[model samples]
Target: MAVVGLPPMGCLPIVITLNSPHGLKQRGCLDSYSSVARNYNKILQNELQFMHNSLAMFGARISYVDIYEPLMEMIQGPKKFGFDKIFNGCCGTGYLETSFLCNPLSYTCPDATKYMFWDSIHPTEKTYYYLFKNTLPILDFLLKD
Candidate 1:
């Protein structure tokens, strides 16, 4: 089984929107939120590793896939991934709105591929593809071993 870690919550469009004094103007992630993600990921990784070891005798293979670093890299250098919108999503105002909040009345961006997020909290398909690519090595290793 493969378990994926949490992405940087600080980079969430809604998080960046409501937390920042400058609102959508700030494309960068909030340090406090990101730090929490980092710490949580570290703990998750450690626990997964322990589980993997404990289950090894039973022929269980548990691979911990890290999505946080890869997503953070994309957020830091979105242009490299052909992403122009890093701080906002493709739906609505790309700010606080998400899920049920984004309905027919909401305004969406012209191209979702250019955006990192599809909603306030989720990544776009394009972003997910990039993240998959980034985690390919780990997945490959998991399959091979």
Candidate 2:
């Protein structure tokens, strides 16, 4: 079994828009939120390690997939992975609109491959592909027994 860590929620367009300072137009990620996510990951990792050790007598192989770093890398350097828009989604204005707000009538970008997110809370297929590709090694190791 492999458990994946949380992505950088602070960097999500909706989160950034809602948390940014009143006068700041850049709308980048909130460091406080990022720190919370990091802390949660640490706790989860420690718990998983304890479980792995406890189940060692039963021949259990539990692995932890650190998705935070790679996802952050993609968010920080989207161009390196062929993504042009890391801060917004493909639907509508790509800011706070998502789900019902990003309806069938809403305008979607011509090319979703250029965007990292499909909506305010979800990632695009291209982003998922990158995440899946990065996790292949861990999956292989887990399956090797």
- Off by more than 4 A, model 2: 22-24
lDDT of 1 by residue, 41-88 (tens): 899889999999999899888888889988988988888999998888
List all candidate RMSDs to the true structure: 1.7, 1.7
RMSD, candidate 1, Å = 1.7
Q: lDDT of all predictions, in order shown?
A: 0.87, 0.85
Candidate 2 lDDT, 52-138, residue by residue in tens: 999989988888888788879998888999999887789987888888998889999999999989987789999898899999998
Clashing pairs in 1: none
What TM-score number comes out for model 2?
Answer: 0.91
TM-score of candidate 1 to 2 decimals: 0.91
Q: Once model 1 is optimally superposed onto the true structure by TM-score, how far is the C-alpha of residue 106 displaced, in angstroms? A: 3.0
